[model samples]
Target: MTLSVSLQHAFPGVSLDVRFDAPQGVTALFGRSGSGKTTVVNAVAGLLRPDQGRITLGDRVLFDAAQRQNLAPHRRRIGYVFQDARLFPHLSVRQNLLYGRWFAPKAARRAEFDRVIEMLGIAALLDRRPGLLSGGEKSRVALGRALLSEPDLLLMDEPLAALDEARKAEILPYLERLRDTFALPILYVSHSPAEVARLATTVVMLEAGQVTIAGPAHEVLADPTGARGFGQREAGALITARVSDRQEDGLTRLDCGAGPLWLPGITAPAGAALRLQILARDVMLARTRPEGISALNILEAEIQDIVAADGDGSAVLVRLQLAPGAGDKTAPEILLARITRRSVSALSLAPGLRVFAVIKSVAVAPGAVGPQAI
Candidate 1:
């Protein structure tokens, strides 16, 4: 399934103009507060009508300003999970979930209740009231309710935003399972880069109400240009990798395009495909191979672009392209190096400069590694 949206909303000093394609799996709507990520999602959920826009989910037209077509939220076959779990205060978890099934047309109710319950691990909470559940449990129940309704597309507005770090960690794996099992399109909204990197199959980046970048999670989330769009401190790179071998010392080796990298943890299975994020600040660049370094990764790349951050003596952003001979030419696997202004001038760094991006093993985010290679 695919979602295409071209929406415009105006409210005095604030205006939102978002346009992007959200493919199947999870498409994360990411931006800082007031960047209009929620507005776009609300438009998709039919909670807010765009001043002018067209929204299509597969062949169904959810909204079209020119045609004056707007599907009510109930009729849109879209499920929305707010930051708050919003479960019924008086109802048991089972009853709350049953309420979702009540909204579906008889013939359209195809998602098995048992299946959804299992997928969300909410079976044990069936008899418990919302007040009796933990924060993560409530969110999982909310997700189960949404799935029970048999939605064609799911809209999660920072589902974990209200949870603490421990709660967020508790829920991420269930979400990964949901993403793998469901075929419906999902538009997940969040401001957290770690969450976006962990969950998004596609990323739509917004800035001041406009879409700054949109593409596969790895491509858009990791590109230096794309990272700069998020600001220097947030810029980084991501690579598709998987656990290839696990050492007894708890260090897991991941097979990446550049080479193997060892990181702490052996939770992921061997041969599962995983995506690894290499933060820009954690990377150091060298023109030639450096010796006796404690860092575990050094990917061969060529400088693709160079731009000053802000001030002359502050920092410079260097973009790199990996394996230039790859088959796809649109955008090669890219990496970013954020170096001091002094270093840029010292090396005369310029576009097309061949270099190695050294990444410290410890800097790689935990659970940021993708599934073991398939």
Candidate 2:
């Protein structure tokens, strides 16, 4: 399913004018607070009408200003998951999940109740009430309820915002499963770079009510020039890898285009595909391969591009193409390094220069890794 949106809405100090296509899988609307992320979501859900625009999901027209067509929220067939679970406190978990069925027509209900419960791992909590559930548990139940509705698309508005780090970690796997297992497209709203790096297939970056960048998650995140939006410290590269083997020293080896990356013990099976987020700030560049170093990851890379330093001129962002074979014109894999401007001048770094990107094995956080689609 594809969701195309062209919207223009205005308020006292905010005027939103944006257009983007959300393809199947998770399309994350990413930006800071009050970036009109939720406004765009609301326009899709029919909760807020645009001053001028059109929203089409596949063949169905959800809103069209020219035609004066607007579907009611209930009739739009889009499941919404908010930051708060919004489950009925008095109702049992099962009851809360089943309640979504009330809005879904009998003939259109395609999501199996038992399957949703199992997918979200909420079968154990079915008999309990929302008041007694943990934050993670409530989010799962809420997700189950949304899935049970059998909507054409899913709208998630920062679903993890209300959870603490532990709860957020607890619920991330379920969300990943939802993306991998379901056919429905998801329009997810979040400001978190880590979440966007892990969950998003497509990222539409909004700033001050406008889309500053829109493209594949990896490409958008890898742009050194776009680092300001994500904050220099949080900017990074996303790499696709497969769990190749586990070592006795308590590390899981992943095979990527750049070769093996040994991370802290990953519980997934050897063949599982995973996505890893490597922060630019954690990477160090070397003109010559350094030996006898504690860092386990050092890949041969060529300078692809160098972005000018920020206002303070204290740092420079460099893009590196990793594992470029002999006579190979295109580098399929890339890594990012943020270093001092003085280092750039000292090494005389320029495009096409060969260098090594050194990364510490322990620098990668467990939360920055997640399952990728096979």
Q: What is the TM-score of each predicted model, taking all chains together?
A: 0.93, 0.97
- Give the per-residue lDDT of model 2 (tens digit) for 1-374: 89999999998898999999998899999999999999999999999999999999999999999999999999999999999999999999999999987778899777598899899999899899999999999999999898888989999999999999999999998889999989888999999999999899999999999999998888888887556678877899888888999999999999787778889958889999998999999999999999988999888889999886478988888998898445545447878888998999999999999999998888999988999853
Per-model lDDT: 0.83, 0.90
lDDT of 2: 0.90
RMSD of each: 2.6, 1.7
Top model number, TM-score: 2
List candidate 1 segments past 4 Å from native: 310-313, 324-332, 372-374
